[model samples]
Target chain A: MSESLQVNTMADLMAQGKKPEVLFWVGCAGSFDDRAKKITRAFVKILNNVGVNFAILGTEESCTGDPAKRAGNEFLFQMQAMSNIQVLNGYEVKKIVTTCPHCFNTLKNEYPGLGGNYEVMHHSQFLQKLMEEGKLKIEGGEFKGKKISFHDPCYLGRANGEYEAPRNLLQELDAELVELKRCKTQGLCCGAGGAQMFKEAEPGKKEINIERMEDVEEAKPDIVAVGCPFCMTMMTDGVKTKEKEDSIKVYDLAELIAESNKL
Target chain B: MGISNIFFIIALAAAGFWFAKNLNKIIRNINLGKDIDRGDSKAERWKKMFMVAIGQSKMVKKPISGALHIAVYVGFVIINIEMLEIVIDGIFGTHRVLAEPLGSFYNILIGSFEILAFLVLISCLIFLIRRNVLKVKRFGFREMLGWPKTDANIILIVEIMLMSAFLKMNAADYVLQQRGVEHYIQAGAFPISGSLIVPLYESFSTGFLIFVERVSWWFHIIGVLLFLNYLPYSKHFHIILAFPNVFFSKLDPKGKFTNMEAVTKEVKLMFDPEADPYAAPAEPEGPVERFGAKDVQDLTWKQLMDAYSCTECGRCTEQCPAAQTGKLLSPRKIMMDTRDRLEEVGKNIAKHGADHSDGKSLLGDYILEEELWACTTCNACTEACPVMIDPLSIIMDMRRSLIMEDSKAPAEITNMLNNIENNGAPWQFSQTDRANWVNEG
Candidate 1:
């Protein structure tokens, strides 16, 4: 867990030769079952390319337990929290970094209660810092594709107060980006959080994510990269659901970074 | 029923009815929101009740109406206790309890309440005139349609009726005070009614005066109680729920929404080998797969309770842009439907959960496709809710269950979900343009 949060490289894991100083907890969206896995893989590859030497741990990844808590099922959430903590601790892993904002927020915020506490950083913060320190170099590869815009996931933007790191990382990648009328702190939910990502809404008018994705579509951007798995899925689904599948694209910020690298 | 006996029985029936109503309110409010049902301390909950439900803080957009309404609220509560003195006098045959400090000051206290009612009446009239006659502009950021002026009208009628009834009782009291009927207590009201009959009452014979005074006693005490009891069954239930809601308003009002878990991990396996359950956990090997709220009973108990707590003040519908913009959404209807659905579902659940939950996804067309998705998750409903009932969370949860578990979402969301699976974002542009938004040259 600490490895995912980038809190510390614990002593037990230190004896291993060539252990990366920080372990990046690429969440489910960055791993499997998420359409944005390629984008997420790009982020990890960029770090690897930059000599950041980060170890990626998968299968050991647990749901951040945030979904359960938000659904008002505190007990299940606690169980999930403990389950994830035990997995992280078992690895004796310390210092964590993550691509998924929901995972970042939950690890930084919710894990303390279950006693699996560590300093956690979003991949944006980690990657952005790496760039700032000249540790991650960008060679400015030829940029191709439509004008792009970034959708801030509410979990990353609001819940954890992370609006700039992702943007900064994107900036390092040298991509021309457009700002949506609603972004950053005032960013709307992708209709994927608060456990809405899992349940059907009370019937009304429209899917919340679709409503948000429409706003992005109106920006006329060809892509809408987001920081949360739920946002990526919801917005991706929103694009297809709106029949905009051919024109627009969604990517994890990490994947965007990796693509911008000498891939 | 003889003349006096008829009035006496009416008084009895009215008192009984009044009590029955408040009792029902207490029961109804018991179920409105998730937090309230969490057994939070009364001190914590009472704050919300005091500020929102009792205070009607959300209704204050119109200073004119809000202030008058506040006055009426205070007057109704304070004056009712004083009215008890009058009722006791009616039963005891004594015009004044003022043998001591309380009774000594009774007339002065009673007079102020009497006058306050009139002030409330005037303010109420002004409100009515604005909405009905002048058509006072709507409150909030949006305009509401088919807005029932009936809520104001009903409250106005109740207030007017109660005050008129009180005034008639006053008339009887003044008459009796002049006659000095110290022990007139039948409805236990004659002493006060005795005052009503005296002075102005002398115009009539003692027999006629007595009969007329008895009639006023029936209307005054019974009227207030009936209004009290009738509260829960009507929109007026907010009268009670608002008190707790306002006081316990979300500590972080600015926080518009909460985050759900990252994946389905029934265990503490942040490092589990296979920890990716996208939406709903792959249902613990076939537990209940709740795609959405199938019935009102499927809602959190607090949601089921919001029906009774809703004051129907139209604050929610008023603030909702969708409702104003001609979408088929009404925050009011949501509350009512949840209640209706609850009633429908509860009857079945009461029979048996397993029996009732057969072959139906909770998200099945009971709630509309549009209403669920149309909500911006803006917390307008949350902020607008006087009782702190978090309906948005409920709406979102239902959606998540449907989309993630049942894979049943609007065509648009489903399409978007597919895109998310394929791409990391919602747009279909080349993977190359993803970061262009931040580096605009």
Candidate 2:
């Protein structure tokens, strides 16, 4: 699988005088975090299977500075944003897709002010579009008739008003989709946003992620599907803490789709 | 004019003057914050104001509370039309002056007012039960325990009294009209008062009925005036400010964090080769601008107005992930603290001129660093605020001042910022290793 997976860089494609359809923005979590890497691989596999022309920025990419901005380091955020914008503009990138909502949000909403403008889509939206066009057919395989609950990522759902795309793809899996008691606009955060992922949570009666998992617990699903990497890490940690990792599993939307399609 | 008419004029004048004075003070306090341009997109702002503030679109999201609130709100606004007749009659020493002109429309107006007044009375009773008897958790949060709790109960009780007095006055007037008494003309319909309550007042003496009508009329008018003056001190100020506050709401997508143009310029300068590194920077013309809000004065006028517009409904806090998880952060407390501190700053300015130092700031004096840090920036608070009060923006701006100005942040956050500065990510992984996952299968 590794040998046959074709990955091209923007620099390589530029040297070859070719342009890809969309740039796959593997955000920091997708790039280096071991767990999130599998999500990136799953999304990439689906793109390849669907015959989508996409390229990666590879080493030329940098963080979109979402964490820095949310953590209130405006100076650092602007520096990183400007540098990323410079590289992105130099490559003449137009359309972007990412497995992380933070990257998608920052690139789509926050970057235009710093002069980085591109059509950015989360992997959920991209996959939903492919499914809409009839290019991607998910057979549901292992997830057929299984109860799957989606934890809405704050950035993706509340921040960006995107609640349907991921669920639309989930419906394609032929699964029993149960909604958490607090879902959509009232969706709870997984405790990893606002740069909380890099820092220990402030003293509280309970960790936020654990509290959020209580909603997942109540839903009692066989699988918890998520769209963001930060939510992936938090929800997975929550499953482990409840010792329900055996009974209930957490998978990104892309991984679920890729597995269903046997990508 | 009769003696009563002269007295009514004096009372109205005094209440109007007092309310105007307080309103002027609030405007000054809000203007103490830095100027911001929310004047763009007039059409969109009007649409939002109409939908959220007038139409009560966001209030109806919770169904039960939404329905009860709409009843009270619509009752309060629509019934005020009757106040116009009351005012005209009181000023000119006339009785039911609009009755002759409005004709059948006046009957319909009074009938609707009677119905709305009844609904308002019931809604107030339910709101009181929810607050005091049931003790809804949102109304019981720590920040809501003091004057906030009393203020909420006070408004509900006041509304109940005002509506009761209105119906009682109408009942006495109806009985007087049936008796064909002087100046008590058969003018308007009073369904609730005439049918249900007029029986209670039927047997009293003609003089006692007149006494009841006069006393009820005066009480209702004076109570409304007092409530008008009370708006400045109570969270009920949302009644007046919600319109403009929603009109000035941030129209951008919730994920779009505002960019710091000052930081952008400095970064652009760093990347420019022709720029002189040794040259002294140009001084700003006005007072040196702070990087982010350190106090209310550093915030924008719209943010300050948001504090004034907050109804203290605790919807934001109820939906807050941090507050739900028992973290120190409560979004309601942020808006309350901002308003409290702004009031304190306002008093200092009023007493000792604008240059006086209060030896206090909103950041450390009111809001703790832990509360700001506890925020997930998930925007549930902003989404839940019925009046569009954005508590998250204040939290973020204060965080900005803490980090950028004071360089004070959690050790982990400092490390994360350092990592992003050096390694192009929030962790220590080298940039070169970013794409290693591509071949790691």
Candidate of highest DockQ:
2
lDDT of 1 by residue, A1-263 (tens): 21122222333345464456677775544555436555555664566467665555443444555544444444345555676677677666578888777677778776765576787888778878888898876654444544678898766665556678877766655557788866764465677665455555645466667667767877888768777667788888888898988888887777666666655
**In model 1, what is the error at residue B144, expressed in angstroms?**
9.0
Off by over 4 Å in 2: A1-3
- Per-candidate TM-scores read 0.58, 0.99
Listed per model in order, the count of residue pairs whose N, CA or C atoms clash below 3 Å is 145, 0
The residue-level lDDT of candidate 1 at B89 comes to 59
CA RMSD of each candidate after superposition: 10.6, 1.0
lDDT of 1 by residue, B1-441 (tens): 245545555676677776775555345433422333345455766765556667667557446657877777777777677666665555554454543546535556666776676666677777667667786544221222343345547777888777766666666656655566655422222333234424566677666656666666666666666676666445666666555445544443233233332333334454456766465644466445343354454455555555656655565665553554445556766765565454454445547753555444334545565666655444556655546666665666665665555555555454444443344323333333432221221
Which candidate has the highest TM-score of all?
2
lDDT values, one for every candidate: 0.59, 0.93
Q: What is the DockQ of candidate 1?
A: 0.06
| Model 2 interface DockQ | 0.86
Residue range B118-177, candidate 2, lDDT tens digits: 999999999999999999999998899879999999999999999999999999999999
lDDT of 2: 0.93
